[model samples]
Target: MRFVPLSSRLLPGYGTLVLAITLVGIGVSITRPYLSLFGTDVVHMSAAELGLFMCVNGIGGILASTWLGRLSDLRVAKKYIMLVAAACSALGYGSFLVIHSYLPLLIVSTVLLGLGASAFPQLFAYARETASRVPDVDATFATSSLRSFFSLAWVIGPLLGSYLLQAYHFSGLFAATAFLFVAVLAIVFWRIERRPPAGILGSQPVKSFAVLQNRHVVTACVSYVAVYTASSMNGLYMPLFVTKALHGSDRMVGSVVALSAGLEIPIILGLGALSARLGKRPLLLFGSLCGALYYVGAWFAQRPWEMLALQLFCATFIAISVSIGMSYMQDFLPDAPGSATALYSNTNNLGQMLGSLLGGAIAQWAGYREVYLVCAVLAATSWLFLLRGKRFKAQEQKALRAALTSQDIETTQTRRAANGD
Candidate 1:
C-alpha cells in the first residue's frame, strides 16, 4: 500500500477522534506531573501511602480497561465507551478539589480516573478499525499521528499546568484537568459518530477476556511492562527529585517534561512512517537502549540543564516505545484491534502500577537518585525480553511453515491414492 500524507487521509470523520484524543492528552498531561507534589504537599501522604494510592489507581484502570476493551469488541460502541471514560475522568479530577483525606481520596481517584483511562485505548482502537476500512490510509501511520497529536498537546499542556499549579494551586490544577476532560466528553458525545462493534462489522478475532497467548505476544508484553515501568518511575519521581534533591523549581519540572514531550512529536511521526520498512522490534530495541541511557544520565546529572538536555534521548525512547508498541501488539492479533490495543495498553498499566509502588518504596528507603538507578536497571532488563521475543517469533514462523509443508505432502499423497497411482 502506498502510504499517503496524514493531511490528505484524516479518514473522513476521524478528525473528531483526533480532536477528542488531543483534548484527553492535554487533560492528562496537565495533572500527571504534579500528582507527586499534590500527594506530599496537599494531602501530606507519606511516600508509602502515595505508592499505595498509585497502585490502587493502576488496578482500577486495568480492570476497567480490560472489561471495556473486551466489551468494545463484543457489543458496545467505542464512542460510548469513550464518553463514559471522559465523564469519569472529569468527575474523578473534580472530586479531588473537595476531598483531601487520604483514604476517601484514594478510592475516589482510583475508580473514577482509572475507568476514565479506558478512553485512550478505545480511541486508538477506533482509529485502527477506521483506518482498516479505508484502503488508502496506512493504519500504522494513522495511529502514530494520533500519538504525535497527543504529544503536541503536551508541549502546551505542561507549561499551562505549571502556571495553573503556581497561580491557582493544586485545586486549580485538578479543576483545569477536570474541565479538559469535560471538553473531551462534550466533543466525543456531540461530534464523534458511532459505528457498530467491530465484531458486528465482520471479524472473528480471539474472543473473551484471555489475552493472546502466543509466545511472541507474551514476551513482547513482558518487555513492554519492564520498559514502561522504568518510564513511569521516571515520571512519578522526576518532579520531586528535581525540586527536592536538585533544588530546581516547580517550573523546571514542567519545562523538562514539556521539552521531552515536544521533541517526541516529530520523532514519533517519523518512526511511525519508517516502522513498516525497519520493523517494530529494531525500533523497540533501539528505544529501550535509549531509555536506559537517559535514565543513567539522569541519575548522574547534578544540574537542571543536564536533566533538560537528556530529554533528547528521553524523547526518542518515548516516541519509539509508545508509538511502535501499539502497532506491535496489534500485529499479534490483527483481527482484534480493541483486544490487542488493550493488551498493549494494559502492559503500560502494569508497568505504571509497579513503577508507582516500587518508586515510592525505593525513594523512601534509599533516596530519590536511587530510583533513577533502579529505572536504568529495568530499562536494560527490557532488552533481554525483546531478544527472547524475537527468537520465539522466529520459531513460531518456522513451525508454521513446517505445518504447511506437511499439510501439502499429505494432500498430494491423498490425491495419488484417489487416482490409484
Candidate 2:
C-alpha cells in the first residue's frame, strides 16, 4: 500500500489561517478572564444581571453567526464578510473605552461585540472556501489545523490576560483586545480584499430554514446544543466551583483552563490530520462519549489538582467536538459550506446561551458540584443523538452523489447541444 503524507493535502493560505486564528483566540481570551469581573466591578451588575448579560452576548453571537453565515454563501466574498465582522468587533471592543455604566455596556456588548464575534464562523468559512478552490486538498484537514490554532491561542491568551488584568487592569485588557482585532483586520484586508471569492460549485444563497429539514443537520445541531451546553457550564462556573467547592484560588482557575487547552492543542492537531483516514463520524462519536466521561470525572473531582488531571479527558473530548465536529457537519452539506458552518456555529451559540441561563439556575438550587452531573447527562444525550443518526449517514451520502451526478449530466448535455452534436 502506498502511504499518503499529511502535508501533501494542505491547500493554499494555510499559514495565513493559522495566524488569523491565533490572533482571534488571543484577542478573545484577553477579555475573557476579566469579562465577568468587568461587568460586576465596572458596571456594578448583579448576579442575575450578569447572567442576563451573558445570555444576551450568546444570543448576539448566534444571530451574527446565522446572518453572516448565510451571507458568506451569497455572491459576496467570504473575506469581505470577514472584514466586516472584524470591523464590527473592533467597534464593539472599542466601546469599552467609553462605557462606564450598565446599559451602555449591555448594548455594546450584546449588539456590537455579538455581531463582531460573528467573524468566527466567517473565518472558518473563509479557510474552508479557500481550500475548496484547490483540487485534491482535504479542506477538513486544513481547517482542522486552523482550528487547533485557536487552542494554541487560548493557552497563551489567558495567562497573558491574567497578568495584564493585574497590572494595567481593564484598560490594558480592552486595549490589547482592540489592538489584536485591528491587526487581524488589517492583515485580512491586505491579503484578500481585492482577491475574487473562491468559486465554489453550486455556491448560492441557501434558505437558512431549509437546512433544518434535513435529519442529519437537525440531529447534528441538537447534539452540539447538548455538547456546548456542557461546555458553557464549564466556561461559566468552573472557576467559581474551583474557588468555592475546591478551595482553590483565582490563579488555579486560569491554570485549569490552561491545562485543558494545552492538552487539547496536540489532540486537535493530531486527530485533525488522522481524520482523513479515521473518518469524521467515528471521531465525533468517540469524542462525545469521552466528553460525557470528562464531565462525570469533573463532577467527582475534589481537589484543584484533580480538576487539572481531568483535563486530559477534556482535551480528547474537545479535540473531536470542536474542530472535528464542525468538519463532520460539512460532510452533510457539501454544496452549501457556509450555511453548514453557520448551522454548526449557531448550535454552539445556542448551547452557550442555554448553558449559561440554566447552569446558573441549577447551581443556585442544586449546588455547583451537581451542575457537572447535569452537564454529564447533557453530553451523554448528545452522544446518543449522534449514535442514533449514524444510520442516516449512508443515505445522505447517496443523495449527495446523485445530485452531483445529475448536475454533471446536465452540464455535459448543455455542452453537446451548444456543439450541435
Where in model 1 is the C-alpha error above 4 Å?
1-9, 208-211, 391-421
Give the Cα RMSD of candidate 2.
Answer: 5.0
RMSD of each: 6.5, 5.0
Model 2 C-alpha lDDT per residue in residues 1-421, reported as the tens digit of each score:
2454777667676777778889998998777755766766788875566667778889999888777776667556678878887888887887887887887788877888887876777778777766766787767767777888898888888888878878888888888888899988987887653444323435333455665666776788899999999988877778778888999986787787777888887887787557766667778889888888888988888998999888888888887898888887776656556777888888888888888788777776778898899999998999888887754465776685456545645776899999999
TM-score between candidate 1 and the true structure: 0.91
Model 2: residues with Cα > 4 Å off, grouped in runs: 193-205, 391-395, 398-421
The stretch of ten residues in a row with the least summed lDDT in candidate 1 is: 204-213
Which is the leading candidate under lDDT? 1
Residue-level lDDT tens digits of model 1 in 1-421: 4656667656767778778888889998999899899999989999888888988899898888888888888788889998999999999999989999999999899999889999899899888888778777777788888899889888888999999988999888988999888888888888877888866876454542343435676678889999889988999999999998899999999999899999999998788668877778988999999999999999999988899999999999999998999987776555567877888888899999999999989999999999999999998999888877763354564554354445545776899999999
How do all models score by TM-score? 0.91, 0.89
Q: What local lDDT does model 2 show for residue 281?
A: 71
Clashes (N, CA, C under 3 Å) per candidate? 0, 0
Query: Residue 215 CA error for candidate 1 (Å)?
Result: 0.9
- In angstroms, how far off is 57's CA in candidate 1? 0.3
Whose TM-score is greatest here?
1
